[model samples]
Target: MSNEDQYGGGVGSGYGEVGGTGQTRTRLPDAPSDPYGTPRRAPRASRGLVTVVGVVVLLIAAIAFANQSSDSPRTPADQTPPAATSTSATGTRPVDGKNGAIPKGFAHDEQGAQSAAANYAVALVSADILKPQMRRQIVRQVFVADKVSELEARLDQAYGKTFLDQAGLDANGNAAQGLTYISRTVPVGTKAAKNSESTTTVDVWCTGVFGTAGVGSTNPVSNDWFTMTLTLRWAENDWKVESFAQKDGPAPVHTDRTASTAEEIAKAATEFGGFTYAR
Candidate 1:
């Protein structure tokens, strides 16, 4: 998506503070001093003052102790199972891959959930899927059986002829000579929206580079930030994507790394094969 599409919008009137009405109330007269006013010796005021001071000190100490405990790092043993592991944190058991390549089992713990989300996001946006055969394999491996056909058809339609041409790829999806096609997604973090013993909904925030890098190519590598939210179901003892959606950015400040020449960028893309990510 273009930058304008990603962030352009108007401010709303709600941004301003609301005005408050001014009102005042008269103070009530002090209660008449105790009726048994037989010169009741100021009820030992110093003793009450001491008690109040002591209570305040105890409260401060208690607050400090609580803060210290909160700040301390919790070990695995100290943590509950769900909070300790991503798979468990997500509350979904890992599934066994139907074949190789598809994630068959994921841990029902935090770490496992994060790993699953990261790996799945990588696979979803990789350049490997541009190849016809590989694309089918990927869809089958990543999606549930019921979703496979629909996702495949949708993806095929989305990555149509015009899209391929704009990306500097041929009709069959191969990059033109001297050009390199790049479609890489790296997850910065994963967050769980809802997790349970059998299901997990996670959003993976990612940064990626896409398009072609080559001299005189219309398309050039550009950076993008997006969040891919995946809803996973536990089946066959593993987690599989039930559904997914993408939205742009929780983007960070851009770095100062100098942009490389097209030739250098193209060469790097050619030399470096992409990885299958894990958290």
Candidate 2:
């Protein structure tokens, strides 16, 4: 069969047929002429068509402009929102459980990933990481089961004698008799670089204090800024750390604020305990 016949657009369909000279096609009346042989006025049909075309073109341009805008206010004509409301529907789900001091059971979505990253950033840099037993606990609680052993071993090696000494802590991760070793991390904000059903990568921006705080201390506590990027896997109905890396931050400019005394710093750190952060 012919291609046209097979596809059902056979001959005599008039798809490509052209009118011949003998066809009685209707024509618009010629424009009117003046007695003085002046140029005739364009046809009423032609003028009416130009006006219609202009209005249609204007309408199309207006619609295109409205659609191209990034910051337009939503209206009835706006595109429909996502079907799943996710975090918004939950309205900051309260974190009511903890594995020791670390918050657990995040929401399993973007908000949950961000909260996990922020909380884990605190655990990663807190004074507890300097202590062997506490470090192991933190690793097990905040990290994936497969990574717990590896992270514990790595942390043990990293927080050896020299490392502790630099931070004014002893082999047991304790400060000298008169000084207090203060290490604390405050998460400023969190952003999820990637979030899916099974995995999430989050960046937590933080400021922290590290070093000994006391009269005549060699390394008095000082503030530093950093960003921790954590990759989390959704395992056992919770977001657990698979891996984490940190880098010096997008820090704000420092003010020439008067420095507090080491004694005052130690007193404040002790008096004002940390918080359990939420989204």
Candidate 3:
């Protein structure tokens, strides 16, 4: 299927001052000697003095608190920004096995979603997807149960006889004997959005090469740029496509570099290996 291009404190003190005069001191006679006399006890501290001491203690405590705050370790949110996760490879490893040739067992996290989306993009745009048996296998492997039958029917219609003829493939979706047909997508980057434990939507931005490569081939290999978005569900400990779509691009301007010969392009496409992408 050409499904390739969809869219202050104060203390107070009182002091008595005594002055000496030249006059002789006079003592008044006691009014009457009392049988019993009790001296008044000294007064407790004044309210102002107590208030000033309380303020000083509080100031000391506040200063100590400020110091401790400065020395405390920062929480995760306060550390240096997590090293640019987008476009940069992450530490999480890709799945170790395959379901036939398809990657199996992606991590059940955002990174897993991204990896699944990327690998699925490669498979979807690959030449194998054009063949009926492989296409059926791919649909069943990548898509969820609810979507498999519908997607299978739609894809079969899309890759029908007419499309095969235009692509120079035979009724069985095979390129003629001498020419090498190439349809491969390499993911440049991937993004995950609306990711939760059970569901995520991932976008894979890709650059692909398509068409047959040979001296007399009518369809010379050409480059296309597109983005594929896959909505995934976490099922049986792996991320599986619930649905997906393709759109034209966030493509860059064409470069002025010289193009390679058809033979070289075909050889490279066959020889080079693809990747198992992570977030």
In order, candidate lDDTs are 0.43, 0.48, 0.50
Provide the lowest-lDDT 10-residue window in model 1. Answer: 20-29
Error of 3 at 142 (Å): 0.5
Model 3, span 1-279: residue lDDT tens: 032111000000000000000000000000111100000001113333343233222222221111111112212233344347466888888898999888989988888889887887666556676578887887688767776676556445544564455445776667788888666667888876558999886666766665567777655555655455556788777888765433445778877787788799989977998876666
Model 1 misplaced stretches (Cα beyond 4 Å): 1-104, 273-276
Q: Could you report the Cα RMSD, in angstroms, for every candidate shown?
A: 25.1, 31.5, 38.5
Tens-place lDDT per residue, model 1, 1-279, is 011100010000000000000000000001111100000000112323343223222222221111111112212232334554543233344444435564546676655666676676666555655455676776677666776776556445434464344334566667887777655556677877767877776767766655456776544555555555555767655666665444445778777887777788777767876554444
Better of 1 and 3 by lDDT: 3
Candidate 3 clashes between residue pairs 3 or more apart in a chain or in different chains: none
Full-model lDDT, candidate 3: 0.50
The collision pairs in model 2 are: none
What C-alpha lDDT, on a 0 to 100 scale, does residue 260 get in candidate 3? 82
- The 10 consecutive residues of candidate 2 with the worst lDDT sum are 19-28
> How well is each residue in 1-279 modelled by candidate 2, as lDDT tens digits?
000100110000000110000000000001111000000011112223343223222222221211121222212222545345422333685377999999998987888888887787666556665567776787678877886665455445434564444444577778789888665667787766677999987766666565457776645455655455566889988988765444344668877888788789889879998887765
Off by over 4 Å in 2: 1-91
| Full ranking by TM-score | 3, 2, 1
Write the candidate numbers in order of decreasing lDDT. Answer: 3, 2, 1
